[model samples]
Target: MSRDEHRHIPTLKRELAEGKITRRDFLRYSSLLGLSAAAAYKFAGDITGVKFIPTARADMPKGGTLRVSMRCPTIADPHIFQWVYDSNITRQVVEYLTLTGHDNVTRPGLLEGWEASDDLMTWTLRVRPELKWHSGRDFVAEDVAWNLNRVLDPNTGSSVLGLMKGYMMNDAGDGLWDANAIEVVDGKTVQLNIKVPQIAVPEHLFHYPLPMIDPDENGVFGVGSNGNGAFELVEYVQNGKATLVARDDYYGDGPYLDRIEFVDLGDDPSATLSALSSGQVQGSYEGTIAQIDIYRGMPGVSVHEATTAKTGVARGQVDQAPFDDPRVRRAMRVAIDPPRCLELAHANSGAPGEHHHVCPVHPDYAVLPAIQRDPEAAMALLAEAGHPDGIDVEIACKGDPPWELAAVQTMVEQWKEANIRVNINLLPSADFWDVWDKVPFGFTSWTHRPLGFMVLGLAYRSGVPWNESHYANPEFDAVLTQAEGTLDLEARRELIRQLEVIMQEDGPITQPLWRSVYSAWSDKVVNFAHHPTSYIFGNTLGLNA
Candidate 1:
């Protein structure tokens, strides 16, 4: 085995023994490190005393339509998708270069495998051979290169740019990515020379918004569904429905369902619940805690739940008045109790957050002292910030999702005691998206990401598009850069601790809890479960015979 391979084995084995990773995850990750699957399975079995067996294709009886109730999407450009709903529609037709499974282990998807340089600054990706696009053209190295450049282009307005800019772009300060950064080495090989050493390159490739698209499509998706995915889009209607049929010549394993349909039940959770209860659709995309309780007792329904880092943030744009003062930001953090918010909004189904973005699920997460709510201290801080008569502010959020609105309501009541008068501005789900990031004080729901750095880079980094709070701190950014490049777990954890401290002390957002997400399906559906990231993997689902 290679020196790097030897270094990884002990960590993988320790994680397996601690129940942090599954045997399948060990095997997949080991294989990427040049270990044979047989050897990896034996190594894992010896440690756990349990052999791992993969499910065979014959076990999945195929050929049925899976109709799921979800919000229909409007965005068709894969490079610039902003919402998970939009990705839900396009992911069926397009594929990603890597796939982060339910176990949070990233494995090759379109690529056969990848290798990183000793310093982790360069990555060499081996594209899988003979893969064909939905249009019957060959999938090649240039396709990958093209997609990367498209996302790196500032004019594209891709959400992925926020995540990749710091590591992959030029330091020329022109916001232009280095043209030579991504190179098509050969027909089946592509290489990336990044500006910084990033450890989460594989995971970032599977970010919901960064799906691999057909180079021939010219940056627009769903026009021809010209993808290399397991399914091809048959019909798509904005705010209505999208239908997809399986590709018989798909490169991957069973797309067990012959057809998959995503039906729009509107933004109301009640509408989706009604559709699910009445059998209008076989499954619902995601359920609120209240809806999950109802689905649990309903006959012929099966609920799948996963604890995730998914959570909502109540934030004030630091560039705006009142919020610009660190005193006011600190006051907001202590004004409300996270445990109480979790209880009122989620029925105490989730763990309280530590007022920072990092979650316990992340590998490099650093546990910090919990901040206690002190309304009196909050009032004092507000008074010190020149708000002696109390400050009146508005919190804006979408009416749908239910949880965001519920949490905001609880926060509003809590802030009342801190002499902070908060007005609730509940907009329709569609309209909320238009102004979600622009609202001075707003509540927004963030989906699950495998790495803490991924979300922090996208949402909190200075000058990025999704910096909801418009928060900028040179010290925090410097620490984050060191953490992102640190490969040693313990060393990374120390750097993460510093970042967490900075966030707790001066961050503009109050993250109350990490959620336990749920989804429900009828008994007729097979092999379908809730994904931690709330991704709909229609390709792996089937109908019971």
Candidate 2:
């Protein structure tokens, strides 16, 4: 019955009883803990076990530099920070907001808690009282309302505006969600009038592009401007290095480390990989399985892999020329063996991917079967599509001994057996997404996000900002919309399952492998991940040697 502050806050009275404190002291403790006298007695037992981590704890000694290595170059803007943190990692060091826990449940990080209307649209947010902003002003609901208003503002070019287009009192696209638009009744209570269920709201607070910019500073965004998180942005040298200092007044207790540094290596992934083994850098993110295995032998490094979402969207283009034909797409799907790809492609660094639009780790995901390799079926389809010998096409690939290249090589080797000619054009990734998202045919990397049905709406759904493949599925879109409105957990899962089936039936991007992503770091670094999208860097890593 260990108590988290989250539980203790709710059952203050019961916890007091368990602690054996006097009723008069219970009344006093109630006020000290910000609970009513009645609630203090009611939840006294729970309070007894509440773990209070005050910043001044003698055991919480903190002052050390954390070093982080990034696989990509420092970029200006990622545009789509809502689910995929498209912004530079240095910016992540400076921001804070409500977010999903590691287990993917709604968590109260920046905000104490929030409430949704019965309709699910239009939420009432309760900001954390007494929290301090980096600028030293007491944080209040105004920041939340202002940030949401910016996302709703059309001029901000916020990708969130598209996902939640209609829920705002004023349609942002047509210019209703404005800077001064949100109702800030006082300071602590702000009402967000969204037309959609407030599921993705937490995601909107993380990564780049979706940051909580200060309304006081116009065009004031990026690393230097934010300071509400556990870390503070200290330095950023584009495509080279970025650094951070701990935020003394962060809502989270502490970073445990004093500083975090990021080094960017563009076009030199091998050199970056070498640094981890040599101990020149504490950790390197988004390394291939081969490199990760190599680092495993190094004295003080740990490797972690996270399940990723593999959508046909933007990975490889399936809407043009040979790929445009659904039969061609089906043949491509049948051409490679998922088991072999999973085995050879990533070398068991990550989980064997299940068939779903999202990752298996995603909350409310449904279980499904993997597709078998049917080269005969693929050959038959290729012949039916006017080529007894397979059609020749080039693929663009990047990562893990170049898994994209390996998948292409496998497809080329397999398609040749079916009389198909395949050529893989290895594209150098100096920020691959910049060009990959626009490419007609290529395989790129991506991480799974927990926004549920929005996965389809963003990549597979029509008219999306990052729809790498031009796919049009009315039924899929309709089902996704239904899922968005369905609050029942299992019902949403079933809706997503239907959408997954739809993707399987109509894949615009041929999946050669469900990849296992890996990241390795020095023992000094803690709490880092190898994301599917390869975006964690700068602030997420805490230096604690």
Candidate 3:
């Protein structure tokens, strides 16, 4: 193919993968460029595969309950929830400013489009006009501003706010909103003034934590009480179950199903799998990697599997003793072997690496030597750090899905080789969330973010509430800030490489494996696919006519 023929194809493929255009649009545009329909679709599939096809059924049946087995956390506040299950339930009722498709591309959601200044300091978002809240109130620019303000509010106690700490101006470290930080530029446009230049504004805006909320919305002691999303709140039983009815006058397209009921399975993956197998629930997004083979061959189930950057991390709080010494942290890193832990935990389903949620799928990915388990080296470092007698520490975890617990148990055995005594403190999944941050050592399950800098900003920034390790370095923070501000692809990758080196050398979190996640549904369900982050909602899901 000539340069002219291939140049536009690259841009068109990106548009299709990012969901800026549909597969039909890709086919139409590619055909104009002298390519067959099959060729055009093949190119598009190469970019994001078929997991994200816009499934619009013409003769779809209307009004039926879509039972889901997503286990929600104790806190259901859209912004405060730490796990995917909580976000899954809240996102059904509360829509985001930007929607991230299954292809990991972000498109307009509540906002029609957005523009940023050359300096990247000021951003202007054009809201979709005439949108309304589920309570029948007109949605305005103020609603958007209020939702963001809540995230910045310390009193709101939103865990995801850690991602926006430096991005948003909060000099007091308290979540108080700066009056000049946000401006309502007329009715349809909202302007945001950042403390520093940031090119990843859309990535943060695409977060599930930034869900639009009505000013009078009551998330506490209630569930799905108020939202501007495609579903209306009908009933809620906290930590148990909830039901949502589709809104007819929803601003956007279809939430084809009449209703969706979220059944709380807690941390029992077996119960969730059994429910899907028995025809009690039509679908579930919580299928585990260990059961992929079983679900794949099941009679009435269709399993959607994809390799994700999502990882199970063991956080060693640096502010606390033994871990306070950088040598001790390094010793911990070298003491445990990731591949062995992965095999023991996930049945060899995960790839062991130094990846902190940034997988090989990212465009900026660079191969770094995987950390090998060096028990002798770890012992020397432990002795050098003034712990010649070996250090005793507690590892807290919410044992679930079987693999994570197995991984943690294997880690304990590995640490013993380095003369490190580890006490396992296993808590229920719900109880784990309560002390996830406060605990000196714990396990956290992280999902895939759109960009590498996103996870870094959320989890590693100094003094941020979610900084699991409490590991602070001036140079690390500066590199992350610079990376997020730069729009150039190559420049950003260099900065990200610097970040990877920082984490590898002295960071306090141990990310062992990245696994393949599978979501399954009954054959009766239609128009559904698993997202890389498993972030899909019920808007386009339906049943056979």
Report the candidate with higher TM-score, 2 versus 3: 3
TM-score of 3: 0.88
lDDT of 1 at 358: 90
- lDDT tens readout by residue for model 3, 263-311: 8776778888888889888888668767878888989899987767778
lDDT (CA) per prediction: 0.81, 0.58, 0.75
Q: State the local distance difference test value for candidate 1.
A: 0.81
Estimated TM-score for each candidate:
0.94, 0.78, 0.88
Cα displacement (angstroms), candidate 2, residue 71, comes to 3.9
By TM-score, who's the top model here?
Answer: 1
Clash pairs, candidate 1, are none
Cα error, residue 394 of model 2, in Å, equals 2.4
lDDT, residue 128, candidate 1: 86
Worst 10 residues of 2 by lDDT: 1-10
Which whole-number lDDT from 0 to 100 does residue 505 have in model 3?
81
Error of 3 at 329 (Å): 0.6
